[model samples]
Each structure stands twice: as C-alpha cells, then as structure tokens.
Target: MSESVVSGLTDLLQRMRQAQREQPHPDASLRRIRLDALAALLRENRPAICEAIDADFGGRPAEETDLLELFPSLQALAHARRHLRRWMKPKRHLAGLWFLPARTLLVPRPLGVVGIIVPWNYPLFLAVGPLVDALAAGNRALVKMSEYTPRFSALFGQLVERYFPQGEVRVVNGDAGVARAFSALPFDHLLFTGSTDVGRHVMRAAAANLTPVTLELGGKSPAIIGPGARFESAVERIVYGKCVNAGQTCIAPDYVLLPRGREADFIATAQRVVARMYPQLATGGQYASIIDDAKHARLIRLRDEAVAGGAQAHALAASSPADAGRVLPPTVLTDTPEDAAVMDEEIFGPLLPLVPYDTLDEALAYVAARPHPLALYLFDNDSAVQRRVEQSQAAGGMCINDTLYHVAQHHLPFGGVGASGLGAYHGEAGFRTFSKMLPVFRQARLNGVGLLNPPYGARFRRMLDLLLRR
Candidate 1:
C-alpha cells in the first residue's frame, strides 16, 4: 500500500477509536441524530449518487439504482430510527429462587470502531445498510469502497466527508492493496460483503487482531420451479430477479431447477418476460450495463465455454447490430454440463442456466451437493413441499413463490449459511451484530447465600442437595 494511504488509514482509525472511547454507549437521541444525518446525506445527493453509479457501470439505469440501492438504504435508516429506543433498552431477567434478591440485565453497548468493506454491485446500499446498523449500535465506522466502481466510490467518499465527522464515519477509496491493509486493522468488529473466495482472505486478515466479523458472501443461489407451481408466474418472477441490475445482484437467481420436460417452456417464458421488460436491449436505458469491460468479457467467456461444452445458448432478444457498449443481452443456457464453467462458479451476471430434474428429491439433492447459497427460491403452493424444503434445505434466506423481496423485509435477518456467509445483519439482528450484549448480575443486600458459602460442612452439603433437587 502507498505510504499516504497507510498514514491516512492509521489517522482515521485512531480518531474513530478515540471517539468511541469517549462515548461507549451513545444515547438514543445521539444515535437518531446520526441516522438522520445519514438519511440526509443520501437524500440530498440522490441525483449525483445515481449519476455516479451510472457513470461507473457505463450505463446503470437510474431507476434501478433507486430501487436497488437508495430505497433500501432509506428504509433501513427509517426502521432503525423507529425502533432505536426499544433496541437500546436493556432486558431484565429474573434470578433463580436460590438467589432471590439478585437480578440479571443484558445491556447492549458499542463495539468500539468498526470496519466495513463494500462491494461494487449495489455500492450505495451495501455501504449504508451496514452503516445504519453500526450507527444504531453506537460505533464509529470506516467504510472501504470497492475499487471496481471508482466514480461511485469517490463520490460517496466526498459525501461522507460532507455529512459526517471524520471521527464518527469515514470512507476509504483505494486499490486491492489498501483493502488488504484496511482489513488487517485491529478494529473491534469487521463486516465484509462480497464473494466467498475473498471472504476467506478477509477473515484471515481479521484473525491477526482477533476481530469479530460478519461476512455477507455470495454463492450459486438457486430458484426451484416445483411441479405444482404456477409455471408462468414462477418464470416471470425469476426473469425479473435475473434481469434487474443485469443479474449482478449477489442474491440473484444464479440458476434454476425445473421439472423434467418443462425446460423448453420455461426458456420461452423467460425470453418473453425479458423482451417485455426491455423492448430494446441494445439501446434500452432501463436495462443496466455490465459494470465494465472485464466483467462483460467474463460473462461472455462463461457463456462461450458453456456452449463449447454442448449447451444450447438462447438470447432473450433477437440479435442486433454490434455495438461497443458493456450491455450483454440476457441469455439462457440449457443442457449445461455439470462440469461447465458457468455451472461450477457463481455466475454473477445476466446468464441463467436451466437444470431439469426428474423429481423434487433430485432437485433438493442437487442443491444440497453445493455450498449453501445466500438465497433460495421456491414456487410451490403445497404447504407440505414448503415444509419439506424449509426443513431439508440449508440457505441463508428463502422466498415462497417470489424472489429478491425477502432481503427487503426489515423484519427478516439477512445473511448466508456455511460458505455463503458467517453472520446475518438486518433490522434488530443487525443492531445486535454490531453491539456487544453485556450481561449484568446484581446481588441484593438480603440474600440466602451465607448458608452455602465458606468451608465445606453438613449445612453446605444439605443446601447443595436441596438446590440440586429443586
């Protein structure tokens, strides 16, 4: 890392540590003020924020940014504001009869300075979502923006400085080397949102300091279309999920599992849905472009490799004149081999693979064989099937007859399972993740512990026996 970047990071961490030490437990009023300021930062710079993301992605749709990034950020802030007081209140627990005059309380306190690493996709929401929780939990935070999205990262850094004090919340803009150094900082807590491979490195870096971490990693999240499902509805929802943000979302349906003999029908329906959603893929501004040339090339290579392995690649829209834009037309792959590159890795783009299954058991087994995904989707009305999937399958979150909406519900705790991720953060779960729940036990003046205290004797044995029996 550059000397200037190292020096700046050191200074920022020291400032945050000092600020947190001075106010270990911020009152609800102060937390609300911080949240209000954050909301203002996002609200006042809405246009610039959208434009910067658009510039970064080459052509990111403004509406998509609003829907995917700005809306959730505002909602998270609003939810935290609404329940901050209750979340901050300590929970009282009654003591056992043996300790009649004692009381136990669980108090939530800040975890000092926190480090947040944001990914390029959904840059704004990922950054602010965790910020809401960190601020609600009364911790100073330093966010490291992804190097891939330079325009948005730089703009967000500027906005953070404009709205927040350097001590309370700061933004870091740098390359991968700086990110490595930032992750190694001895913060009280660290939260990283990105791919699983990188998550391992972040965990290793955090381990040197023994810092607690919340990893929001991604995997090959699957969408299963059950035999009893509404076929057209399932395809439509999956299309919406896959096409939005050009299927760059971490939790977007990476692939699909459909009943045997329905592959052709599903593909046709998905194509129709895509066409209707974006009448002109080449020129439509509604459809977001790939983040950059490298990502676009990667997606193309995955598709080409799958085709070379004997898979059938079908473009959603008819071919158009060649262009230099980063947009890759939504494509669906059928007959993809198990060993195909697209099937092996998390396809973080607009390419979707359709896997046919003979039975629900086979579908469930297929998912089981892979790492637990961040999100799983099922389109079945049967309560029995839902129950079976709920009990059998392991995933961070699920949606019945829907997709992508589960993460938006503030009441739900969002995170991955196993390789998908380690910890969850959303709503109150998020607040608790950032805060340390310190348990306090208070002993009253009048207690019956004297009988059990002191050297071993007949009285102590008798008292122990009575308590044990009780």
Candidate 2:
C-alpha cells in the first residue's frame, strides 16, 4: 500500500464521515433524488459504460450488458424509489405484557459512512447495486473500483463525481495495493464482492476498524439435475447460465451434478443449445469472449488438468475454435476427479464439469460435504425433491428449474453463506443491511405500579412474586 493511497483514502473517508455527521439521515425526498440521479447516470452514459466494459473484457456484447447488467440495476433503483417511504417508516411492535403501557419501535438509522469494494466481472452492477442501498439508507459512501476493469472503473470514478455531490458518494480508482489500503479504512459498513480467498483479506483489514461487512463472495456453485427434472429445459437453462459473460459471472453454475447414465443426454442437449445461442463463437456477437488472456489461459489449464486426471472433455461448440478469438467454447467435462482444480476451485469461466451421482441422497451428500456455495441450481419439477434438496443443501441463494434468475429478483435478498460469503443486500434487504435499526421504547406517563423499587419491602416482594408467577 502506497502512502499516497492510504493518505488519500483516509482523507476522503474522513470527509465523507464528517459530511454524514452533518445529516445523519437524509429525508425520503432526498433519497429519492439520489436514486433518480443513479438511474440517470446509467441512462445518460449507457453507451460509454458498455463500451468500456466491452473493451476491458476484449469483447462483451453491449445488448447483453443492457439486459444483464443495466436492467437489474435500473429496476432495483426504481423499486427503492417506489418503496422508499415504506422502508424508511419506523416499524412498530407491540409492547410486552410486562411493559403493557409502553411502546416499541424499530427506527432505521444510517450507519454514517459505507464502503463498497467492487469486483471486475460485473463492475457497474456490483458498484451501483450496493450504492443504491447505502444511499437509500442515507449514508455517505466511498466506493473502491476493481483494477481489472480499469477502463470502466476510471470512467465510473469520473462520471460519479459529475453526477453526485462531493461528500455524498465518491468512486475511487486503484489497483490491488490501493484496494488493500481502502479496505483498512474505518467505514461504518463495508460490502465486498469477489472471491472467497480475497474476502478473507478484506474482512481482516476491516476487522481493524470493526466495520460490518457484507461479503458477496463466489464459491463453487453447483447445478444438480434431479431425477424428475424437465430434461431438455433444464439443460438449456444451465447452458445459458454457464455461457453468459463467457462464464465469468460469480453465480454462474460452476459444475453440474447429473445422474450417472445421463451424461450423453446433457452433452447432446448442451451442444444444440450452445450452437443455437452462439452460432459462431468465432464471430458471434451474442457470444462473449473471455475477460482477458490470463483468464482464458486459466480456464484452459483447469480443463487440461481435469482431462489429465481421466476426465473426458466434450466441446459443445466444436465447429468454432475457442482460441481463435479469445472466446473459449463451452466444454463439458465428465468423470472429473474429486481433486481436479476445476472442481476444487470456483471456475469463473466457460468451463462446465458434470459429476455423476448414483442417487439423490448421494448427490445431496456430495453438495453438503463441500463448502456452502453462493448459488445452487436444481432442475427438479417435483415438489418433494425440490424441498428435500433445498432444505438439506445450504446455499446463499437458489433457483429451481432454472439458473441465475434468483439474483435478479428484487423481491429476494442476494448473498452467500459460510465460505461463499456473508450478509445480503438487495431491495429491502439492502436497505436493512446498510441501516442500524435503532430500537426505541417509550413508557406511558401512567404505568402499572412503582412497587418494585430498590427498597426490598413487602410491596416489592409482592410485585416480584406477581411478576415471577406471570
């Protein structure tokens, strides 16, 4: 960490903190304005934002960016804007029997200053998604953009300064060294979205300040094809999830669990789906290239290691060469060893591995044994199987008969569990995550009795007896 980076971040954080102290809680109207500005920021610079991300990724379609990244961000902002009053209004609770003449309510108070550490994969969405919550909670924020997406990160830093006022929010652009220093700042709350390994470092750094963290870390999220799953439909959904963003998405299915006898069906179906979705991985606009050469090489190494360990690699889009355009064709690996790097690590690329299971119990056992994943996909239409699997297997979020759609739901809170990540933030969940919900109790002028005083007399004894009896 450079002294300049540390000093700069410290200075900025101090300014934001002082600004938050001035107005601990912004009114609903002010929050509405902030939300509108965020939406406008996206709308006004949609093309530039998309282009920067595309350039950073080498080749990511702008339309895909609109649908996947822009849509959810805008929709979530609208949701917050529409429901800001209801969310901000203090929630009342009935007084307990012991305190009959008192009132209890939960008043959400801003946590002062918030820190959002954005990842490169979905820089725009990740940054704005949490910013929506922090602003709605009426807290000033300082965001740390990922170094991997330099083009978009720098652009966002400049664009945000133009839209938002000085102290309300500021986007900081820096590399890993700067990120290390930024994480150490004493913000009231910090939300980090990235790998589990890096999450540990962030948490440790934030620990010095005792900052509350909401970590959206991605682990090996699994997709299980249940015995009664809608066969073709399930494969189609999983293919789309894995191939989108060239499988760079955090919640994209890391691997698939299928019945031992159905490997061929999955391969055939996946091939047809991939070919249809991206007719020419060689030149197709819908098909996204790998984020960069290093990521591309890493995916190949994972695949090659899996194959060397006795797995069979079946290229879904055999006609279109992956290396030709930095676009890795969707490849499904079967007979993958338990210790293969692809299976062991979170595969954040266009490599899909299928694990065969003899029974549902075995499949559930397999998933249960591993670290809790960020997301889980179940392709079962049977209500009983869905309930059993979902109940037994613990994941941050889940999608039934589909994939990746769960994260897009504004109604649902999205986050990970255990190793995958910690805490959640989206919509109302996001609002609450960034708030400190202060508990307030008011006593009526005329209460029950002043019998239970420090003086231990007959009346105090009697009052205590009555209370104990009740």
Candidate 3:
C-alpha cells in the first residue's frame, strides 16, 4: 500500500521492457528452458503450493488442488514444450493467381512484455496458463496475483522469483489500489481472468495505452437437460460440475434447465450424487469451502432472496452439520421467481437453481434472452437435439454431455462472448493471442507488378477490370 510499492510496478514493467528490447526474439531453446524451469518449480513445490492454497481457502483438499490446479499447470508447460517448435515456425501460404510468382508466409512474433491479471478462484492455473502462452511466444511477462488469496499469491511470487530470471517473469501482489497501478502500466498485451464487472475496468484502463487485451470474464453459465438425455447420467455430471471447487469455478454450471415434470428426479439424482461424492458431507475433506465470508454472505443473500420470493431449498449435503471451516454445503433451489437475483446474477457458489422448461426450444430461448454465457452445457445423445442447441446458441464454448470439461481441452480456444467476456487463450489460440502473425510476402525478381502501375492509362484500366473480375 505504500507509494514506493505502487511505483515499483512501473519499475518491474520497465525492467521487463528493457530486457525485451535487448532480445526481442528468443529462440526455441531459450523458450524450452523457461518451460523446463516452470515445470521444475511446480514439480518441486507441489506440497507447499497445495498447502498455501488450502490455507487461503480455509480448507480445500490437497487432491482437488492437485487435480484442478497443479496438474493442469504442469501439463500446459509440457504441451507448450512439445509444440513450441512448430508453433514458432512460420506458416506457408499458397500464392494466388493474381499475384503469381509471389510467396506468402505468416511469421509469429512475440508481443513484447505481457501483463496477466490472475483471479483468486483458480489462482495457480490462471497465472501459469497465460504465462505458458506468453513464454512460448517468446515474450517476457508481468503477472498480477489476486489479493484475496494472499497466502498463495505470496508463495507463488516467491516461487516465480526463484525459478525465473528477474526480468523474464515477475509476479506482483497487492490490494485493489496496487492492482489499479499495475493495470495502468503500458503493457504490450494484457490478459485478465475474473468477473465481468472487473473485466470492464481492466479493458478501460488498457484503452488509454491502446493496449490489446484478452478478457476471460465469467457470467451465468447454464446446463440444459434435453428430453432425450439419460436423466440420471445428466444429473450426475451436473452435480460434479457444480460441486467441484464447491461451485467456485468460473465455468461452473450456474443453474439447470430441465423438462417441467422432471424437477423431482433431477433433485433426487443430484442429491444422491452429492452424498456419494462428499460422503461425510459438510466437514468432508473431499469438498471445498467458499473463498471467504463475503462470498459466503453474498451466496446466502441470493438464497434468502430466492426463498423469500417463494423458492424451496433442498440441501444436497443435508446429512452433515456445518463445519468450523467456511465450507458451504451444496444446495438446490426450486420455484424461484423469474426476476430474482439468483436467476439474473452469476452464482459462483454451490447454490444451483432449477429453471424448468416445457420444451427444448423453450430452454434454448431462455438462455438466449440473457447475456451470452462463458460456457453452455447440453446433456443429450440425440444428434438432432445436440445440433439444434449447438447451431442456434452462442457461448464461449459448448460441451455436448459434460460440464467444465471443455476447459481441459488445451487444443480448444477457452474464452467467452458478449457479456461473458472478450477473448480466448488456450494452446494454439493462446499462442496466437500473445503473438502477431505477420504476413510476409516475397516477390519474384521478374514480377509484372510494374506493368499495372502507370499514369491512369488504358493498360491500367484493363488490369483493374481483370483484378475486380478475379
């Protein structure tokens, strides 16, 4: 919070910028070295990282951190290491007849120093995920870790400093004021992963510098249970998706849309799955706690407001009592009024609302009426039903019969649209996002372009006609 600390952000950026100027384009070997160091950092400090996140969250099981965060972070490095050579290579393009004897190729160039703002929900993965892309693209990076998870953020900063050279990768940790200072820096490119409201501010600040930004924001992502869906299977998957991280995931299914009469069945299956997954319920180490008291209170307010509006609450983890840790039990609500806050806002917690529909088209229409979501889930085996939703709807990504799995596909572009967010970054999409694919054209020594360039003559007119026709 000190003035010196805030100014240090500009210092970190300037150092990275100076280093980038010294070596604008790093070779594949150097990029691989960065990947190796990052991998080693994750591999060696698994226990410490898990412990830090657990402390930050109050009590998140180590296995969940390993599966959801650590494993993905390391996997991203390996994937980048394996493909960086090819990704860095220039892509050849065929010359068109209009420009015969000329060749074209797209050369991927790094976008200098990148600024990444990481969110608290999945701090480790979000930090490393974008860093992988920036490093692979041969750019130095400055990362901002969320203040909400101070323990993990500090530990991560320490680990990064130990693994990377001073200017290659720097991690900044501070409160909102510090974050504002960090974002205000004139980074070459910026990527942020967080809520939509904050994403807007990040974009506005970046606009001052005309710095390109990639906003991975979140909205009310939904899951639709098609008429042809294996009802029980759909419930099980939805339960897993919502319950993972105790529904703290950005891409978690916010609510369920199902056929009107099947509400009881969905609730039955979901409760059963939750009980099976968490076994001990409230105090189980398998489940996670709400990030903090404020988030917990917000979720409680949403639930209270819904119930006051005539909704019925069903406790998925009803068997066990509340634990000392701030863990919120998985919950489902029914009969909530259409305009309730729960129905409108992004529910980044364990409370799942049921939005019943008479027909598949009704469900689709309901989703379309709202802001486009970061992710859409459809549970159906019928090809027609699948195609109908896939083609007619808009989402950052779609999972035919699963939830939260689309993000695991490193090959696919992971991002949102409309109110959900602004851009994508994952694997190749990420590589391109952090780079500029410059189109290089090489003309033959004896080309005829000169012939078409004259003082508005008859030959020029003829060539213009031919060009227009082609």
Candidate 4:
C-alpha cells in the first residue's frame, strides 16, 4: 500500500474503534442493519460476483456457481435473517435449588470486532457464510479475502465499502504481508478457513492479541466403503464432493478406504461414475478447473509419487492432456502401500487412493492412526457397526451413508476435533460462536437465604446443616 492508503486505513480503523466503544450496549440495531446491508450487497453483486469468479477461473460455469455457491448463500441469508431476532433473545434457564428466588438467564453479548480470513476455493460462500454468524451475533466484522482469487476479492471489497461503514463492516485485501498485518490486529474474535499448516500461523498471530479463535481448517478427510455399502451411490457422492471446485474444498473426501475384496469393483464403479459426471474429459463443461497452477503442480507431484511407489494407477478415461488447464484426471490408485507418499500427506486433489482394509476393525484402526479428519464417511447400514465407529473414533462430524452433506444442514454444529480445527459454526452454533453467554441471576426482594447472613448461631448452623444434608 502507498503511504496515503496506509494512513487512511489506520485512521479508519481508529475511528471505527471509537464508534464501537461509544455505542450503548453495542447497538443490536446496528447488527441488524449490517445484516440487512449484507443481504443487499449480495443480492446486488450476484451477477458481478459470478463474473469475477469466472474471470479468475478463465471462465467458470455460471450454472455451477448458481447451483453450488450463489443459491446456497441466498438460502443461508434468508434463514439467518428470519431467525435472527429469536436467536438474539435472552435464554431463560432453570435456577438451582440453592438460588431459589433468583431467575437465571443467559445474556448474549457481542464481542466488539471480529476478523474473518476467507479462503479462495469457494470465495463467495466461505466469506459470506461466517459473516452471517458475526453479524447475527452483533459483532463488527473485518474480512480478509484470499489473494489467490484477486478479481473476486477486489470486487467484494468494493461492495462492502459501498454499502457499509468501517465500524459496521470492512474488507481488507492484500497478499500474505497484508494478511499478516490484519491477523496481528487485536480483534475481539478471529475465524479462519484454510489448510492445517496455515491455520497454525493464524492461531499464533491471534495469540498475540489474546483473541479467541474459531478455525474451520481442513485435513485428510476419508471416505470408507463397507462390505454391504451401495457402491454406486457412495462413489457418486464422494466424486461429487471432490469434483466441486476441482477438489479444492477443505472437507472434500481426500481418499477412499476400500474393503479388501471389493477394491476392483469399487474402482470400476468410480470410473463409470466419473464418465457419467464428466463426459468430455478435461474440457468438459460440467467440470471445474483447479484454482491455480501451483495447486495443480502439487497434485501432479503427488500422483507421480504414487506411481513411483508401484501402485496401480488408472487415469480417468476422458482426461486429455491438451486441455489440461489446471485439470487433473479423476485418477485412482490401487495396491497402495501403507508407506506410500500419498498416504503421508493430505491429498487435496482429484486423485483417489484406495487402501484395502481386511476388516471393519482394521478400517477404524487405520483412520484412528492418522490425525482426526474434519469429516468422516462411513458407508454401512449396520446400526451396531455405525455405533461402534461413532463411539471409537473422533471427527469434526460424520456422515453415516454419504460424505460432506452433514455440513449442509444449518442446524448441525460444523467444526473439527483435535487437529482438524477448533470450534464450530452453522446456525445457532454460529450465533453462539460470536456471542458471550453472560450468566445473569435476577433476584427477588424476598430472599429466604437472608435468614443465615453472617449470624452463624446454633439455630442458623443447624438449619444450614439440615439444608446441606442431601
């Protein structure tokens, strides 16, 4: 940034802080206003957002954006707006026997300003979805759009600036240096969505401010096909999640965990599914391109590593080298050794590795051995096995018969445990994420406990003892 721009930003931030400090009770009305503005901003910029995303991807499919990104955000916005008032209501609670005359309530208080670091994979939804929570919880938001999606970031910044004031909603755009500066600020709360490695850096930076953080980080999420699983449905759902945004989603199924005797059949079914999904190979209009060349190169290297380790590789029948514009074939590998490079790292690409497991226990053991995934897919109908898997293993969330669909339900809490990430946000969870639940006990004039106030005589002691004896 130029000297003038930096000075302007510094001045603006100071002014916003002053305004927030001067507000009476953080102005819940201001929160509603910001949300209303956000709805307007999105409604107005829908076309422009689609265009910028297309420009970034050298022409992303508008229909796909509508189906996958735009429509979902609109739906989320409507749902949040409709329920914001009730979510903000003070929740009444049961008073304990000891505090008999006091009424308990959970008072929702806003954390002053929040910082949201959005990723590029699904820039539209990722940026706005969390913003919904921040606004609903009555907190001011400062957004950092990813540098990878430059066009969309620039446009989004413009929309935010035009509709909202810095004190209400602000957008910051830049490369890593600017991101570092933004993250270093002592915001009241910080929410980040990205890789596990970068999530560490964000947490470190937020620690400087002593700021609480909610990380929606991703890892090697796994999809396991059990013996009685429906191969076609399982493969289709897994492929759909992975292929969305060309396998750049944080929660996309990283690889497949195949049962021993069913590996070949699963592979064959997956190939057929891919063919049905994307008929024209690399240049298929239905398929999306990888976000950038660097990611494409990394996936290529991972594929080469698997090949070098003597795993049987099958390239998707339709991937043409000529039209490989950041395009990777929906490839699969078999006979993958436990020590293979693909097994060592998170496979954030279209390549699927099939690691055969001898039994259900072995499959559970394999997943348990790795860092807990953000989402786990268990494709079995047996209630006993499902209960066992759910009890024995830990994950951010699980989909019993499918993959990644659990996140779509606004009622569910979405986040990871252990290494996957910390904290969850979706519906009420999102509201709570940005809210401080202050416990309040409203007292009545007639307090029965006044009888024992500092007059520890024989009668008081005897009464206290009688009350304490359960």
User: How do the predictions measure up, each by TM-score?
Assistant: 0.98, 0.98, 0.98, 0.94
Candidate 3: regions farther than 4 A off? 1-3, 319-323
User: What C-alpha lDDT do the candidate models reach, one value each?
Assistant: 0.92, 0.91, 0.91, 0.81
Q: Which structure is stronger by TM-score: 1 or 4? A: 1
Would you list the clashing residue pairs of candidate 3?
Answer: none
TM-score-superior candidate, 1 or 3? 1
Model 4 pairs whose backbones collide: none
| Local error of candidate 2 at residue 120 (angstroms) | 0.6
Q: Which residue pairs overlap in candidate 2's backbone? A: none
Model 3, span 1-470: residue lDDT tens? 68798678878788899999999999999999998999999999999999999999988999989999988888888888888999999998767887878889999999999999999999999999999999999999999999999999999999999999889998888899888888878999999899889989989999999999999998999999998999999999999999889899999999999999889988888888987888886765788888999998999999999999999999887634554567788889999998899998999999999999998888999999989999999999999989888899999999988899888888888999998888899898899999999999989887888877769899899989989996
Give a tens-digit lDDT track for model 1, residues 118-223.
9999999999999999999999999999999999999999998989876899999889999999999998999999999999999999999999999999999999
Error of 3 at 448 (Å): 1.0
Per-residue CA lDDT of model 4 for 1-470, tens digit only, reads 45655565556567666766877255556666777888898888788888898778764677778777777677677777778878889999767877677789998888777889999888988888889888888777888999999999999999998998757788888888777777777778889998888889999998987999999888889888887677778878887777776777778898888778777777787788888878875776566777788877888888888788888888755665765577677788887766876787778778788878888788889899999999999888778878888899899999988766687777788899888999999878998998898899888677787777886888888878978896
Which of the predicted structures, 3 or 4, would earn the higher TM-score when compared with the native? 3
Give the TM-score comparing model 1 with the true structure, all chains together: 0.98
Clashes of each: 0, 0, 0, 0
* lDDT score, candidate 1, position 190: 97
Q: Report RMSD (Å) for each prediction in the order shown.
A: 1.0, 1.2, 1.3, 2.2
Off by over 4 Å in 1: none
